[model samples]
Target: MAPDWPAALRVYLGVIAVGNLVWEAAHLPLYTLWNTGTAQEKLFAIVHCTGGDVLIALTCLALALITVGHRDWPLRAFRAVAAVTVVLGVGYTIFSEWLNIVVRQSWAYSELMPVVPIIDTGVTPLLQWLVVPLVALWLARRTVQRNLVVTASMNR
Candidate 1:
């Protein structure tokens, strides 16, 4: 049997929240470690880490919570949340890369070479964009299926 669209959407939204929270939580240690390092370490860290990815991940979680609901509210809210997450994620990712480049230019590297920033800024937003539509479609399909089952049952 096909999955219900509303059900799928709920699951997907839950995923966005859980995934972002998990990713951010996982990075706390790394951020802490980086902060403890010297100034030289800081410069290197900024260049190497995609700080924007962290922000994007956080935004995803916030949007996910805002979008969750049992009825029409969830669907309506999904559109707004999805749009915000995509826009912010893209903007933040770009800003992160730009910051790394500027930091590298202004600061001098010690024994460690300046590393490239991780360009995974697009990952979270892209996944979110795909997820919303997929869930919507799944919900639609499920609704149709349920209607057909009900109709057949009534006829019999």
Candidate 2:
């Protein structure tokens, strides 16, 4: 039987939120704001960035679902969905870093931040997209499958 996609989605989103929150905090020292900003500002930066990360993750997954997913996603079309979602996320991160760093000057990275060539995007944010969502999807699927099995056993 197929695992419940809705339950999997909820688990996926929850993991995304937690993962992004941790990633944002861990990478704070890579940004200029970490040293230049006050304590409150640093906290705000972490929260704000984490919030944005969550939104991006949600949007990317939703788009992937619309484009490549079906009712049995993460089961039938797992690879297609995961690939599309990660690519969308990574593509958006690249564009956003370029925009914010070059055009808007909304933020700047510290010397500690290692940037990708040509793109000039920080590796941490890029890695965040690659690591967080992938882990989230994996955990979400495993968790849902376990729950479904337990429920089935209980009913038997």
Candidate 3:
């Protein structure tokens, strides 16, 4: 049977939203927007960060789904989510930090932000990708699995 694309998309969006919020909250101290900026500017910053985070999360999800080899639902979910956490965490961290901070000067890290020893990237952004995705995926997986179990029980 074909997968329900709409339902899957809703799940993905839900996960991304929650993950972005968590990341923002956690890293706010490390990455502050300009305090003197107008409300519109601050809003733009918030939107930009949220949008970028959603894109990265979606990319990770796509890569995970494509790479997951298992036919079994639970195993496939576990593997896919784990893959997403690692791949997106490391890959996006390096790429984005370099592009935004080193190359483009899009955003500057606060003095409070700790730099990773070797990579020279802020620790918060790296942890954001790692922690938020894992938490979001785990929550989504549990919710889906629980619904599936209930549906199966009802059908039986």
Candidate 4:
């Protein structure tokens, strides 16, 4: 039987929200804001970025679901769904980094931030996309499976 969709979505997004928040806080020192901005501003940046990260994760997952997943997802084609999600997230992150850092000058990195060659995106944000979503998806899948097991046993 199919997994509980609503519970899975909640787990997926909850992991993304918490993971991004912690990741943002951990990596803030690598940005210019760490040194230039006040403590409150830095805190706000972390929260704001975490919110954006959750939104982006949701969008990427939705796109991946439409393109590669089915109504029976997490029970089938999970790897494909995950791969598409990661690829979409990474691609968008690169573009967003270029736009915000180079074009808009909305933010800048410090000397400590490792940047990708030519494209000039931070390694941290790129890595964040790769790591956070995969972990979130994995946990969500686990949650769904456990819920399914419990549901099946109860039904029996």
Candidate 5:
């Protein structure tokens, strides 16, 4: 049977939301200490981070689905998720770092933050794409698999 794309997408989004929240929470101190801004500014920063993370997660997921062919099985789907995360994570990190930091000067990284050797993006942001999305994708795949199992059992 064909997979339910809508249901899978919902699961993916939920996973991304939770994953992004955790990612932001983990790096909260870094951002707060680095910014030295007002409460409203901090709130905006949080919102911006969350929004951008979600966009990256969604784009990676879409690319993965396209590359590996989304399947009903969790394991199969995970291959795509993992592959795309690494590929896009590295690529986007480089491009975004160059664009935002080098070119536009939109944001500046603190000296405290560790930078990737060549790309110059912060370690946290790079890992944010690589690690967070994998976790989110895994959770989403598990959810979809569980639902499929439940539906199959119900039909039997």
Candidate 6:
């Protein structure tokens, strides 16, 4: 069985939406406040990072719905979006990891910054992007398999 592009896209979007919800819900308290020193820094981090994630979640949801509804369009749009996300995710992940390594290596010479670069921060959320296409393909295949099984059973 082959994967279905539309269904998978929807699932990917759903996953992203849920993930963003979690992120926003968890960080909102920290972001919405004004504080000094480390508290202020964390507040800023929550605002910048979680705000961007909310936008991504919205975009994914809308785009998924649009792609699913447009039955006549080619798959190129979905593929392009997925590929771009992958590239961005991979690039960010590598750059973040590299920065961490550099910081750690020069720890003695450099001033200790309150903020540290987390490798996974840049790498992990891309899972939803990657899953979109893969899951879409899987869904398509499953649908096909189910149809085949049902058809076979009917004949029997």
| Each prediction's number of clashing residue pairs | 2, 0, 0, 0, 0, 6
Q: Sort the candidates on lDDT, descending order.
A: 4, 2, 5, 3, 1, 6
Which pairs of residues collide in candidate 5?
Answer: none
Per-model lDDT: 0.46, 0.90, 0.69, 0.92, 0.71, 0.44
Model 6 bad stretches (over 4 Å): 29-87, 90-114, 117-156
Better of 3 and 6 by TM-score: 3
Cα error, candidate 6, residue 84 (Å): 6.3
- Tell me each candidate's RMSD, in Å, in order: 9.8, 1.1, 2.9, 1.0, 2.5, 9.4
> Least lDDT summed over 10 consecutive residues: which range in candidate 3?
1-10
Q: Which residues of candidate 2, in runs, are more than 4 Å off?
A: none
**In candidate 2, which residue pairs clash?**
none
> Candidate 4 regions off by >4 Å?
none
The prediction achieving the highest lDDT against the true structure is 4
Write candidate 1's Cα lDDT for 53-133 as tens digits. 444444653565455422343334445554555655555645653564355442222323233347423343344335533
Clashing pairs in 4: none
**Best of the candidates, TM-score:** 4
1 or 3, greater by TM-score = 3
lDDT of 5: 0.71
Alpha-carbon runs more than 4 Å astray in model 1: 1-55, 61-73, 105-156
lDDT per residue as tens, model 4, 22-46: 9999999999999999999999999
List TM-scores for all candidates, in order.
0.33, 0.95, 0.81, 0.96, 0.82, 0.34
Tens digits of per-residue lDDT for model 6, 45-137: 556655565455445445544545334222334455444445554455355435643555311111221223554232233443355334543
**Predicted candidate 5 versus true structure: per-residue lDDT over 36-85, tens digit per residue:** 77777766766787888788777876777777755653446667567766
Whole-model lDDT, model 4: 0.92
Error of 1 at 136 (Å): 11
> TM-score-based ranking, best first?
4, 2, 5, 3, 6, 1
Task: Pick out the ten consecutive residues of candidate 6 with the lowest summed lDDT.
Answer: 106-115
